[model samples]
Target: MDVDARLRELGLELPTPMTPAGNYVPAATVGDLVYLSGAGPLRPDGSMVVGKVGDGGLDLDAAREAARLTGLQLLAALRAEIGDLGRVRRVARIFGMVNCAPGFNRTPAVIDGCSDLMVEVLGDAGRGARSAVGMAELPFDIAVEIEAVVQVST
Candidate 1:
């Protein structure tokens, strides 16, 4: 599909790709699969969404938005690595982590923000295996962090 066109159709634009927080590269490719490192919710200006997400903390809806933003960052990294989103043949997997208050159990629901965006952008090719879990903390205290694996056509 025309991935760049699809983002505009959704009224979304990719932010500048983020640099790695540490010594790791943002993406690595082996054969046709590109593995993305975790990405946080970085705003267009580069500030991050930081907080614990859950009851009496950051609102779930806001956390979901953070996840979506994180997803956008992942896409940015993916495109940077692969040259074009059209190179993606399938979204193979995702690992999502949410920094949350104690006892929050809706990790999957919150991560759907990213999942939904993938499906919206790539249709069925974006449907992929996923795991979402709550965490006590994440790098920079970001509300959500997501990593992805995508299969691309050579």
Candidate 2:
């Protein structure tokens, strides 16, 4: 199936590409690799979804949703840059961050939301190594943020 079809099958719609919050571009390509800057959860209407996971300020479930949303946002960035998902060969790695309580230990599970969706959309090729970490806080109080590297057709 095509990328659009897979996305629809998973009931996800990509949000519009967000402008970089700082001086760097959202993504850049080097050879066959596309490196994406960390993306915070963005609602479909362009507003940010703000809350910290396990902070009592946000629930775990919501954080997972935020991660899933972040994945979609990354895909949107990929599409905007490359013009198509078919150009993607494989997702190489992802780094996920969740703002959390000092003792919270569910970082890996929260990041699974993004990992699972990548596999759902791109099948086996999407499977990749990942690191999930907890932070005292994240920019804009976002629940989750993620960045990725993928191999793409030249």
* Best candidate (score: TM-score): 1
lDDT (C-alpha) at residue 50 in model 2: 84
Best by lDDT: 1
For model 2, state the Cα shift of residue 136 in Å: 0.8
Pairs of residues at least 3 apart in sequence or in different chains that clash in candidate 1: none
TM-score of each candidate structure, all chains considered together: 0.97, 0.95
Assess the local accuracy of residue 71 in candidate 2 as a C-alpha lDDT between 0 and 100: 94
Q: On residues 1-154, what C-alpha lDDT tens digit does candidate 1 reach at each position?
A: 8999999999999988898989999999999999999999998877899999875668889989898999899999999999989988999999999999899989998899999999998889999999999999998888999999999999
lDDT of each: 0.92, 0.89
